[model samples]
Target: MNHQSDQYYIDKVLDGQVNMFSVLVERYQSLVYTVVYRMLKNKEQAEEVAQDTFVKAYKALDRYRGDAKFSTWLYTIAYRKSLDALKVNKRFVSSSDIKEIGEENIELVEDALSCLQAKERKQIILDSIMKLPEDEAAIITLYYFEEKSVKEIVEIVNLTADNVKIKLYRSRKKLYSILHISRNEW
Candidate 1:
């Protein structure tokens, strides 16, 4: 949505045009869900958290002082909510299709394994990202996936520019290793 159009929608929503808020919801639903899904890795949990993120965003809309872009604010909520869910669950929830036999004995079945091919390499990279430390993952997601610049990322992640750069470097290396991609490829 254009800046003027988004601000209009937000103003309307704030002025008791509650139903109109769905437009904003529809616009951002997939982006929010993808962020939650990447972090939680469970379809059901991700859906639930995504829903909560929207609801929370709606209830807190008045508190949103327009200091950041709507996309950034929405993603910050989703990221935080996903982290809360992970903490509550006490373990990372892999996709239901994934099965584990032991610490090092887990294996993806043929169908699931196929999803890790070159075509699905991005998903594999995302899976590895989900395993990263929360701050690092947030930086990677905001900067790379969301296309937020370093200054914007600093605001969202509340890190200094230097720290964010170091984290990004370490995160890229870690993601490359976890995805089994050659460093040169990265």
Candidate 2:
């Protein structure tokens, strides 16, 4: 629930109450999955990577330095694992392919987006996110969905704070373009 509680669980697990590790997994699995899925965009691969992320965290548990939040440390593992998977799969989207939507259409698209049901809106956003290049999507997901600070994201993604900020900005523009185009089809 809180960092202190997370530390308590970590200490318990380190003390040989290994079952307590499940609590850590349960608390963060979905968060880790979201990050992986956003990058890989494959259900099976994402699930596999999520499992790997936990396994990695468990194996490296004793090395956790406590300088970062447990979630941040866990995310760092997830992020690296996802990148490793990406390297193996060689699946990548080009950011250059993300066209910039006209400024005039932004408001119109926002209005159309608002008219959709929440579930539909969320699905559209998720679908669009899947179209982004891996790094951009990860940046957007971490900054917006996971509510991670730029500094925290830097640790996870191995990017500078300014790079993360720029990616977040550009990713939003790309997403807006995707949404605007999708709105027109409705």
Candidate 3:
């Protein structure tokens, strides 16, 4: 596997070396699919959206200004495309009735999950996140799994910095609440 800056491939693709685009896809395919899956919560739909994300990126590659990291730009496309998928499919679930998480923060959830095997813990965490609304799910995936900063998330989600913070905070609280319930269901 050769290592090269993302821009190196982007430059090559722009120079009419179309096959170079495969390198970018190979680099980001999993992450793009994961983010899409988290938001859509349906493997088939997420797969379509993820592929569309790459197609859109390829078509618009020339518009990329190199201001943000390539991954961030790709994520922005993934996030929006998933939102479009949700709109088209009309399956988005809202968490408005989910009563206050009350007393169950992520720390407590982590403690509860400590007994599970690592794989189970990770899947449980991902499942709990998938139960969230699309926006919050995307936020949590970017914050925890991808380690994207608030600024990066803001760019990806097209939200204000403060808005992203508020959503991230509420998403954490909501996530722990979901995990708390899951623990009890076991």
> What TM-score goes with each of the models?
0.74, 0.88, 0.90
Stronger candidate by TM-score (2 vs 3) = 3
Model 1 bad stretches (over 4 Å): 1-4, 92-119, 181-186
**Cα lDDT tens digits for candidate 2, 49-156:** 999999999999999999999899999999899999999988776755455322342334446766767876777787788889887888888888999999999998
- Supply the TM-score for candidate 1: 0.74
lDDT to native, each model: 0.74, 0.85, 0.88
lDDT by residue (19-103, candidate 1, tens digit) is: 8789889888988887787677779998999999999999999998888888788887888898899899896544332221121
Residue pairs in steric clash, candidate 3? Answer: none
Candidate 3 residue-wise lDDT, 61-151, digit = tens: 9999999999999999999999888888887586653432322333344456666668767877887787788899999999999999999
Say which prediction, candidate 1 or candidate 3, comes out ahead on TM-score.
Answer: 3
After superposing candidate 3, which stretches have Cα over 4 Å from the reference?
Answer: 96-112
Candidate 3 residue-pair clash tally: 0
Clash tally for model 1: 0
- Clash list (residue pairs), candidate 2: none
